[model samples]
Target: MKKKWVHIIIISVVFLYLFLPLAATFLYSIAKEWHNTILPVSYTFSAYENLYTDPRFLQAVGRTLLISGITLVLSVVTMATATFVVFMYLPKMERVLQALVMIPFAVPGVVAAVGLIKVYSSGPIILSGTIWILIGAYYVLVLPYMYQGIRNNLRTIDAKRLMEAAEVLGASKIKGFAFVIMPNMVTGILLSALLSFSILIGEFVLANFLIGGYYETIQVYLMRRLNENGHLASSIVITYFLTVAAISWMMLRLGRRFGKTEEIKEKIS
Candidate 1:
């Protein structure tokens, strides 16, 4: 009983530590003035109102989503294909492939940005200062998450047996992958995509360095306006947190639903 109470106290303290800042930010976002007070002098939605009223803010939101979506799609398709090929055709090279995929984690963002700029600034394909550069950078940034998530999930199933079974039933390699392997991997793919989207949406270093003014993402917009308005910044952070939380919750629901469906299918089979 004493140990359980100690654990409860520790958990409570951690939750309070994590939540207090968010609570304060939410209050500040609505507070008309919080000067030298424990709470706001008054409350209003003007910060959010003003935030939405600005056309640039809307543009930033759209741009952020566009980048995130593009990165998510690119990472998912590429990693999925790569993992499938390595596991199906080139099992012996899995370690090499994993090392290659993990190269991004070893490289610092600043170094990568500089290398990209130096390479693409005056090349045949000038991607520095373009949305393409941001997309490419984001794709690399999220590769590890997508690869590991899908690869680990794939390992849980007997992928070789599944593919062979599909082949024995007279399915082509393409059909086997599309129909058999793909469906089983949907939950993992979706989870990875959500995680990638969240990471890309919150990314700032590459955005600010690679395509700052040419294409303004939410993070870029936030950085630019961070000093101008405290309430507006707080509102942006709150909105971002809410959006990420929603995606996370959706991922959880998907994992549970998929797990149950697979369990039922196993019993039926």
Candidate 2:
């Protein structure tokens, strides 16, 4: 009972922490005018309407989708390869490999972007002022979250035991890993996709600095007009939220389809 109260209190605090900002944004989005008058006396969808009609918003949406799609594919590829190497092999260097995986998070985002920018310029890749740079930046930014999902899914499955069982039955490591382990990690993949999508669609700081006017990601576009246009900015926020909701819902569906029994039970209860 004591523990239950603690959990309840903690959950309450977290709920407030999350919902307050979202609620404030939603309320502000609808308000005609907001000031220090305790509350805005009226609300309207003018902001949302303006957002849809604006050419900038439409272009931003397209760019955001493009960037996010690229990011998702790269994140999935990187996470999948990392999981295979770290979980199935790397017996002697698992710790070292995992530490490397955490490098993206440990290094500051700005520092990493600057380093990458320098390397790309120096190397024969010649990826200056291109979508590739944005995609590469997304690859790193989304790594920590995607890694967590992959690593967690890895932890739940007894990779060694499964591999042993499969090898004895004449299956190759690639076949066994792909056919068996991949299915179990569906939730993880979905989670990684959701997070990667979110991060990519709304990434601003790196996109602004590294991407020199070739491909304007949504966040970058929004930031450009924010000082001059409140309605357009609000529209971007609302539209982004809708995108996030749709992606998250799809992930949840995929997760529940697999053996996410605990999540299902919670929903039912």
Candidate 3:
């Protein structure tokens, strides 16, 4: 009992450490007058109102969503297929693929952005300053997440055994992969896509460096608002937090539902 209470206390401290800043920001967003006070003397929704009234904010949000959706689709399809092929036929190549994915982690976003610009700015197929460039960069950025999540799911489902069973039943490799292996991977793929989407939405460095005002994302818009008004910036942060939280909650719910369905299928089979 004593040890349990100690653990609870530690968890409470960590929770507060993480949540207080968010709480403070939320309060600030609604605060009309908060000078030298424990709480706001008066509160108003003007910050949010102002934010909603801005056309640029909406455009930024739409562009960010577009980029995130395209990147998520591209990453999931590419990484899932590649990982499946590697695990199934090219087992020896798994180590090489893992090393390649980890390279992004070692390279900082700024350096990668600069290198990408240098290569693409004057190339025959110049992508610099285009939405395509941002999408391509985001695809690279989320590779590790997509690869690891799908790989772990494949392992958990014992993909090799499933494929072999399919083969015994006279199912070709492609058919087995499409009909059997891919369904089991849905949960992990959704989870990874959610994580990647969240990361891409919050990311400012590469978006700012590569595209900037040529194609403003939500993060870029938020940075511009930050310099203009503290309360409005706080509102942007709060809105962004709620948006991501809602998405994460929805995706996690879907993941759990998929997990349950897979379990029932396994039991039935």
lDDT of each: 0.86, 0.75, 0.91
The TM-score obtained by model 3 is: 0.89
List candidate 1 segments past 4 Å from native.
257-269
Among all candidates shown, the one with the greatest lDDT: 3
Which RMSD does model 2 reach against the true structure? 4.9
In order, how many clashes per candidate? 0, 0, 0
**TM-score against native, each model:** 0.92, 0.77, 0.89
Write down the RMSD of candidate 3 (Cα, Å). Answer: 2.6
lDDT of 3 by residue, 1-269 (tens): 99999999999999999999999999999999999989999999999999998999999989999999999988988899999999989999999999988977999999999999999999698999899999988998999989998887887688899999999999999999988999888888988888888889989889999999999899999998888988998998899889889988987897787677668757856
Q: Clashes in model 3: which pairs?
A: none
RMSD of each: 2.1, 4.9, 2.6
lDDT of 1: 0.86
Ranking by lDDT: 3, 1, 2
Cα shift from native, residue 38, model 3 (Å) = 2.7
Two-way lDDT contest, 1 vs 2, winner: 1
What residue runs in model 2 are displaced by over 4 Å at the alpha carbon? 1-24, 32-43, 241-269
Model 3 scores a C-alpha lDDT of 0.91
Name every residue pair that clashes in candidate 1. none
